[model samples]
Target: MSGKGGDVRELLAQYVTNLEDDVFAIQNLQGVVGAVMARYSRAETGLRETLLREFVKEDKLKLAKAYKLIERVLIAYGDDSVGELEGAHLSFENISMLATKVIEHRRIGGSPIEQSTRYVRYDFKDPERGYHYYCPESLKDTPGEAVFRDRMDRMFANYGRMWQPLNQWLERHKPVEEAVYDLGDMGSTYADMADDKARKVFERTYRNDLKTKACDILRSFLPLATRANVGLFGNGRFFQHLISKMMTAPLAEASHLGRRAFEELTKVIPHYVKRARLLDYTAANERQMRRLVPRLVPELCRSGRDSGIQLLRPDFENMAGALAGDGPVSAQRLSEVWADEEECGFLASLLFTYVRAPFEVIRQRVRRMSREQRLEIYDTYYGERVTRRDRPERGIEFGYPYTFDLVTEWAVYKDLMRHRMGSIQFQALVPDMGFHMPGELEEAGLGDIARETVALAEELFAYLDAHHPTEREYAFLQGHKMRWLLGMNDRALMHMLELRTTPQGHPNYRRTSQKMHDLAVSLYPDRARRMNFVNHDPVFWSRSDSEARQRLKEQALEGDETAS
Candidate 1:
């Protein structure tokens, strides 16, 4: 081995030996040295090797000195240096309200996997454990605690009651294939099959599907305080930002989470995240909003009223059929095409950065260019030839701007909200717009159950709306419709369309994306053609087979059972 490699191996070995004698500290040091080693292996091999050698050969005093030097350098280097190092997996067990806030911290750029309400049965409870909900520390000694606890208990009871009936309904109405398949048809029932494992697998699959539908219907009744667990994976820099924001957040739960997360994270990757601190700006922003909002528009602050989507710009006269009713409308009917004079000006502004000459000269040159030449330039800028490394020139995309007034389901809106490039204004959640029932639930003969559950939730929401308007949204399901006005350029739309139109995406959002694409094409046919990845098809993709294989492997390790 090379001298550098030998030194690394020795240092690692000594570190391990030291950790063996200090088991408690090993947990704290796990991601720190690993992250440092990874970065050094890539770029700072010589410096890393020298530091390791010095620490391994020197006494306790020297080792402490080395650690302090490393800490100072990391803190001084700021976000860029620490951003390169990843954090260890951090586990969070909290209420759904806090989980949503944590997941919505997009600035962290972390990937999080939370417990699925679709697949997991939250109704299972032990008498000793009690119903799962978070109680704020301030509520402990107050009379309001009794009221809060009683309401939460009632919600859980309603949620539990729906499960059994929903399951029975699904079983009775199993698909025709599941009901009538012969012995040879593996795609359907396994009635003639003698294999116990195959029978168990079939039962498990059907049960899971039934549970998913039931949970989807019942989740509308669940309070924001319902307990949830999430596994977060982020880099050290992301954790620093997350910790800072969480600490500065207005919610008491967020502050509690921030402190707890910081304690655990600092133990693992101290150097990378040592500079994390709550920002004064975040607090000031929240304070200003609270002070200014009610004073300026007291009537606007009223709750429980439906704030449906509205189109303020693009001339109301031009919107013929799109703004007719509250129901879903075709994109073609909704948008107004820009006039020739207006379009020319818009296109010039978009191409402003691309022009090499002065503003007036470029304006004249763009006006003179042939239609074919303009199209050619756009094609060359964002074409099939452009690799991931070589993004299209930003100048070409500056010309196409589109805006839409959208009324979509809360679930669909959540997916769209992830696209940060768009300027979106959302209305408060309300059930007056109605809810959507999944086609799968309808197919399984549980449409009535789904509809009735939403109605029940709306009834409860009405009560909360009158008594506590701010908390009424807790009763909203994924199917509940919400309105939002979206304003974005063509470049943002291209990215949104390419992603949301995939076959794997939810059917509702896929329809939304398809409509958006249609609108774009209707207005700017030449530019719309450049967005090549928008897919609209009946095909579906799933990871169920791989998941089944993994389950089988786990089962095999537990016993001698074999999967056919």
Candidate 2:
């Protein structure tokens, strides 16, 4: 059988491609099966099918076992599966089972991003390539046989007039069959024959045959819209990727096709299937983070005096008043207050801007210390510049001494923006600091790779600080980038610790977030709380409860192994 639907399997393949670690693939599989089995077993007739006529039931327990076995095998050898299956002289049934295993694994925690249809408004449904109507027959009504005969006579008279030359030529040509064959053999009327030779042959051969030549000429003039579903296919991801590429293509067809496909696929994969979401780095939320966090500010503000705490003086509600907006609080505005040299002398400046007070006190204490002292406290985790300047009014202005790679810059910008603050100040440079650079090698040069490498090294060094290097070194080498930076903040840090630091977390943001968790632990070693980081992407939403449970079981097993 032709695998017309094989394209659908490619999406499943993409999920496997991302399972870079074989262990993760297996753990995820175990989790999926465990979760599914738990849920089904708990139900009244989890695997049992009812027989209507006999009023009996048959258990599908064996099928469920087969499914679990497939899930486990795929997870255990997932990274080597495609190759192993290729080399193994397995039966077609075995290969089919393997495919099913892959799809089943994908269904658990791996699926395509979901998209919304209603919100995306599409406008360009071109008229030149749209709905058309065709009619095959028409007839005339008459009062009587005489009337009908008269009409028929008129029609024949017109037809005879039209065909007079051709009819005369045919009669003169000798044999009717031969003349008819010559007329019928005209190639121009064939839809596929677009060449001038075909047109010329048909025209010359049928010149005396008016009807045939007319048909040939009409065929050449047929609208390009006659063929509608030209390149349509079921490969949505490929279609989506193509559409994304075509949006910028010079050809009208490419752009139109891309935009149409993108819009259509969005309905199915809402989270992952949309156009690129370009970030506005200069937005207020990003600018404000430096103000709220003392480390981000050039000049450290104090809790009392000019920037005094509101708790001591409720009449001075500027801090609370400033933050009480309809939308999110701006980190840039807070950074501006802290960045001012004169603002550092007061208690109110730094205190009220925070949700908690003790954290602010620790920050203020760090601010009062010299650059070296603050570095000593942070244990010297620096990717950027480290410097300090004595401020006549604000006490001191501590700055990041080293310039960071664009990756760090973008990463910091993304993090601060997520905080939704607006008060931060960047230092003036001989070259403009706010002017952005491309993050990718294609956009930048090899220099970016070097810078990124150094930055990543710095991040890993910071991550290794908390653990007993002797015991954890082996696993630490294989650690997800986020696992290195856990327990860096207060509640916000704890929130992530509770959420994303688990074994089955997203890889990108997890490390940076773990750094936040680390900071939290330092501030509140006694009262830290953790939160769960739920995968908000719609693709994971369809997983049954049992699958989730199985995942937990697998994680427990993995965790026990790790402990050993």
Best by TM-score: 1
| lDDT for position 1 in model 1 | 18
Residue-wise lDDT of candidate 1 within 1-564, one digit each (tens)?
125435444445444444223332222234444334434534544433433544444322243544554565565533255454546678888555434644554433576766766667767665875676665554567564565566656656656765676667666766423642222223446474467876666556555545555665555445556677878888776777778777876566677787888899877666656666775654654454445434432333443323333322333342433266646765544432234334333344334322222222333444455777555444433445432323332233333367555667776676676675765544456676766666655655556655665666676567667765545665566677766556578788899989988754555677888887877888788998789899866432222233344445655665664433
Instruction: Give the residue spans of candidate 2 off by over 4 A.
Output: 1-409, 412-416, 419-491, 502-508, 529-564
Off by over 4 Å in 1: 1-51, 58-66, 77-79, 175-194, 293-407, 413-479, 483-564
Give the alpha carbon lDDT tens digit for every residue of 1-564 in model 2.
113344422323322333233332211222122223233323453211111111111211233443343344434433212112211010111111111111211121122221111111111223652122111011123222233233223322322233334334433443322322111232224343357754444333344233332222112111111111222222323333334444533233334444654565555432223332211221222234333445533343332211111111121244455456636656886665445322322332223222123223434454465655444322322212332211011112222121111112222222222221112212111111121222222222333432333333233323322332211111111111110001122344344445554433323334434554444344444553333342333211121222234434654686699999
Compared with the true structure, the alpha-carbon lDDT of candidate 1 equals: 0.56
lDDT for 514 in candidate 2 is 52
